[model samples]
Target: MATVAATSYVMYVILRRDLQTKLGWPLGAVCTQAAHAASASMWIFRNDPNTEAYTSNLDSMHKVTLGVDSEEEIKKVADKLTARNVDHKVWIEDGFPVCIALKPYPKEEVKNALKGLKLF
Candidate 1:
């Protein structure tokens, strides 16, 4: 019999590109939003096994930041993640959605869910 090693966990942060092009938000503000989303998700899933593995390996912790076009697009992604029962946090500012952070998950487990997004 043979055994396979589990895939390493990854955290995915999706930000709204419009924050810059449409809203004229500075790079620092956009970065802050991403940080807020990532921190919130990590705190919410702190006890999750995948999160535990990801955090314990700080030097190799994997995080991907992708970009969506607008708030509607981000909401759609959040909805899909919710339907798949993926743990995540959606950060809103001034009553509008800014970005989202998905809890650490095996790369293969959440890869398809992020299709169509581009690197931030």
Candidate 2:
């Protein structure tokens, strides 16, 4: 059995589902947007307390990836998070938004903000 690491913090990665279905983007390219969103958010909030704690134990760091139906859907989530002062980054490709990643934060503090998303 694999070990489960306990931690209070989590990184939320939200990607556009249409990238694969409607947009016909290659899998690798879609994955790259996720990478860009995550890394950029991590760098931007590197100094946050939760981020510091989350990175301190890299092996146990927790991440949750969710999917949205379209660019507008993803942007809606980002707006909600921004209203709550939740640190995050939205990645844009070719002038269209495709992904959003939230900085590490206690799961409880951010769960409701992400309650509407489905696992990717």
Candidate 3:
């Protein structure tokens, strides 16, 4: 299911490149995945491939952006993660969601652990 969801997400981006122009950024998938993980970890352990819940949350943020049109969206994402007890650092460039830095977590070590597990 995870693989299917990941694939669908990639395909969605591929099919929506034109739309992504205004709503695009480098590492958008990574950012979206991070967003999903952050939100899902907060609400519950949503392991389902169905994206209704996660996309709903993203839609809510998008709606809010329609009015504020500032850092509100990015801040809201970070705030949601923080409110849910997820320790993360966020960087927003030019009002778009940029890099999300997990606080105090050895990302390289985590990647190494995943590699050791042969998950990649």
Candidate 4:
């Protein structure tokens, strides 16, 4: 058990670094890393704190179904979020934002979603 635990910890660290450098995803953003003791407690990092770029991106892509007029716009939003390594989900009825819950989230996205943006 001890050996397995130690090995897991080492692998986790290595993978975290690789993912960040390769995919630009923050260590905490990944579910595996986030589930760990160390990475789970880390502080949130943001490139733009004043925007809902993350939520908007997820909502735009995952929430909306195909054949909508706003598909282009939503795709753009999703692209932006992907560029930033943000993950989210969208609603089929109305481009609602679904996302992983985290502490100290991008305040701007919360505010934007709060304004009748439909977040879940």
TM-score of each: 0.92, 0.92, 0.26, 0.24
Between prediction 3 and prediction 4, the one with superior TM-score is 3
lDDT of 4 at 11: 8
In candidate 3 the C-alpha lDDT for residue 50 amounts to: 34
Kindly provide the TM-score of model 4 when superposed on the true structure, using C-alpha atoms. 0.24
Please list the residue runs of candidate 2 whose C-alpha ends up more than 4 Å from where it truly belongs after superposition: 1-6
Candidate 4 runs further than 4 Å off = 1-69, 92-104, 108-120
- By lDDT, rank the candidates, best first: 1, 2, 3, 4
Q: Could you tell me the lDDT of residue 35 within candidate 2?
A: 93
**lDDT against true structure, model 3:** 0.34
lDDT-superior candidate, 1 or 4: 1
Candidates 1 and 3: which is better by TM-score?
A: 1
Clashing pairs in 1: none
Q: What is the lDDT of residue 23 in candidate 3?
A: 59
* CA deviation > 4 Å runs, candidate 1: 1-7
**Model with the higher TM-score, candidate 1 or 4:** 1
> Model 3 reaches what TM-score against the true structure?
0.26
Better of 2 and 4 by lDDT: 2
Local accuracy of candidate 4 as per-residue lDDT tens digits, 1-120: 322111111101111222345456565554343344222322232343312233334333111112112334444544554566543332222233212223223334433322322321
Per-model C-alpha lDDT, please? 0.89, 0.88, 0.34, 0.30
Q: Per-residue CA lDDT of candidate 1, range 1-120, in tens?
A: 753222377899999999999999999999999999999999999898788878885788889999999999999999998998888999999899999999998888888888778898
Put down candidate 2 lDDT per residue, 1-120, tens digits, no spaces. Answer: 753233678899999999999989999998999999999999999998778888888888888889999988988998999998888999989998999999988888888888868999
